[model samples]
Target: MAKCTAVIDIGSNSMRMAVFQKTSRFSFHILHEVKSSVRLSEHAYKNDGYLQSATMNRTAQAIGEFLSIARSFGARKLLCVATSALRDAPNAQEFISRIQREHNLSIKVIDGEKEAYLGAIACANLLPKMDALTVDVGGGSSEFAVLRNGKVETLYSLNIGTVRIKELFFDRNDLAGAVAYIDNALSALPDFGIDTFIGIGGTFRALTRALMKKENYPLKKLHAYTTDDVRFQTFAEQILQAGPKKLKSLYIKTDRFDTIKPGTLILQRILKYTCAQKLVCSGVGVREGVFLNDLLRNSAASFPANYNPSVRYLLDTYATHSDHGIQCSHLVKRLFDLLQAPLNLKADYRHDLVIAAKLLPIGIGIRYYAYQRHSHNIAMSGLDYALSHTQIVLISHLLLFKKGSRSSSLIPRAGYGTLLPDNATVDALSAILWLSHILLAARINADTLSVHYIDGKLEIRGKHLYLAKEQLRNIVLPKNLIVVFQE
Candidate 1:
């Protein structure tokens, strides 16, 4: 595989180019990106599947510009794929041939099923592992991939995207007929006892952004942001009632207001059709899927099945030192074994404990004072895609108190009634992490210390206890746990 590969995704609404820099197998990030809203479906669908000349010329121009940008970024290879609008266009081969002849760019026009598969590839590897209906609402069509047990069980593509729906249904005065048509198209979709909807593509992202803005959400990241069915229903209704003149006020993109409402209607029906209760938005789509598939084609390239993508991204981006974090994680695992029964904690928390241990000190690099709160902010905002929102909140709380700093004024206040568990579990987890920090801060050899739970009292048997005895005494712990220091 090339060190840097450029992926150009020609969709119905927009043509986008993403340059990915591969740091390692299954590890990469977008180095550069560019997009142009060509809206090929706007003309092609209205003109009997014949791609309009002006639209094709505009697409050719965008492709030429994107290719230039990619080359300027030192891209070593290129993978260009065109979706629905091009696939359904009668003269798509002519357009592809013209680009090839004029600019030496070979564009692969993928079928609906292949497009759905590529979209699923991205969702399976990058998003949280779950049973979901991954819906990619493009401009010319919508691709649905039903993921069961993290595998694609069914794939379907409907010729009803934002642009297509707007062209077909926006002018219809018979509201009942429009809904009936939508329902008839959606009736073919089957529900697999799955209530989670994973929404991909630009329309869903715009909705997530607007919803986040409305709530004054602190985190700006989009992946794995979930919205309840009630919120979505309200928004969908608002979009349905909003005219193009009023759409700009709804926080949708100015260019997208014309079609966003139609998109929302399509998504609302999809939610009902699939009996899904919640929608998790993903910023990734067919472009990322294409890149990942092309990358893994090389025999030496692969990603770990259990590795958390967002976790690695956060650690690589912000962490100053990983040795301490790794050592603390090891120490916490050891304590979970020794303290689980006494603390009344279950093994379910072990996964969160490990993640919190590694991420607890990331904020120290920003500043030492109030570093735990900083770490909390980083985890809440940066670490995502693998854990549930509840797990994320719990992990943030665990990291907040990891350094033994339990101030009443600290962040993540106790007002979230049921968001947190009973205080005992939090205290125990905090104390265990705090103890791990102190034990290692004493410069004791990581391998020399062993924990023993004796008669409900905690003791750390180590080779050099005398050297750090005074520092250990200064640290605070959960008052419930009887701690013993023995040399």
Candidate 2:
């Protein structure tokens, strides 16, 4: 039986409910998600730091609606976690009681330490393998986690947040003071080793989307999107100088004007503090964290280190089984190993080529004609949890090449080709996949199929096979590689 769970995370700035369907023992995919900008922290920190009765009532209603929608998905398990705003309110118990008494729901208000750890769990598992200083910046507080070697070495939940900063520091023209506040508040944080800043929460996502628009980024996917400090600073300056009207002109949602600039300003401080050059925006945060925690409850693993790819899990859940993918994967690797000598391709491509081969048949399972093209789209935008943005593009291109990807339109130009390595990189890898594909489709069984540098001419010594017009296209390799097949 398929087990599904919903995690409803009530944060200071927004309320989110994510439904995660367990696709495998260790991995799950988002079945459904709904978020509301309830801004539970609105005025909750004023004076005595009590959740205004009206604010609590409104957020409670949002929670009830989210729970109802979650129930519709047949979610057998529901976990609700509230952070920051609720934790700070002196009358938090009163609000919690109201949730239980009115909606018969139990809300676990976790502490700052747990909140930071959960954010780490979501990031370490979903993003690529990289050491980063991760920050889950919320409306009420920001959680900093130092991720090194797939583990969070240090974490802190500071009271510095977008909403808090806006309230206390936005009106002050002294930008230096705001940064000084951040530095002072986070004085206890240890010296950071990694330079990559993994920015989470809605504000960072909003900033990322806005930057994507400014730069006309092509991928259109938000997770794992990276931007350099210079580009982001340009937007940050505009956001800082612009009012709500100007932000709208820049394509930033007007609703975010009240907080986006402040958030970006805080981000600037974080960058300076860590001297990080890159900001990897993660769409996953505390809500996804809660769902992952529950999903891995009984498992021995506590992190993303050994988790199965969410792509593999989703394919399994959809019952898209393909033994051909497995076969192609093996055949492609063998060809790469045998051909790399004369091809002069790097060993780094082997893993990517294998992934490309394994995921090829998934598109055919969807439709037969131009299935490779469909596979290309899925690989670029659909698969999740493991491969980096670079890997995704390479795999997508390999899939395209596997099906004779040669035309100008067929080139999978992600990051406008700049993000992709030089043509020689994919060219050689694609050549290998293309040849392996032909042999697999033709069922050409050869006792000896190998590449040999014979008399300075690449020779194919395989079973004297007839090459068709299009078959020759498969043999076209990178300008640098010279190879002859022999069987």
Q: Model 2, residue 367: displacement in angstroms?
A: 1.0
lDDT of 1 by residue, 40-80 (tens): 76756667888888888898998889989998989989999
lDDT of 2 by residue, 298-411 (tens): 653264444446567635643266466666667777777766776777898898888777777667767878887777877776766656677777777667643334423356
List pairs with backbone clashes in candidate 1. Answer: none
> In model 2, where do residues sit more than 4 Å from their true spots?
171-180, 298-308, 317-321, 401-409, 412-415, 442-487
RMSD of each: 3.1, 3.4
Worst 10 residues of 1 by lDDT: 402-411
Which stretches in model 1 have alpha-carbon errors above 4 Å?
A: 172-177, 244-246, 298-302, 317-322, 360-381, 393-404, 407-409, 412-425, 442-445, 466-468, 473-475
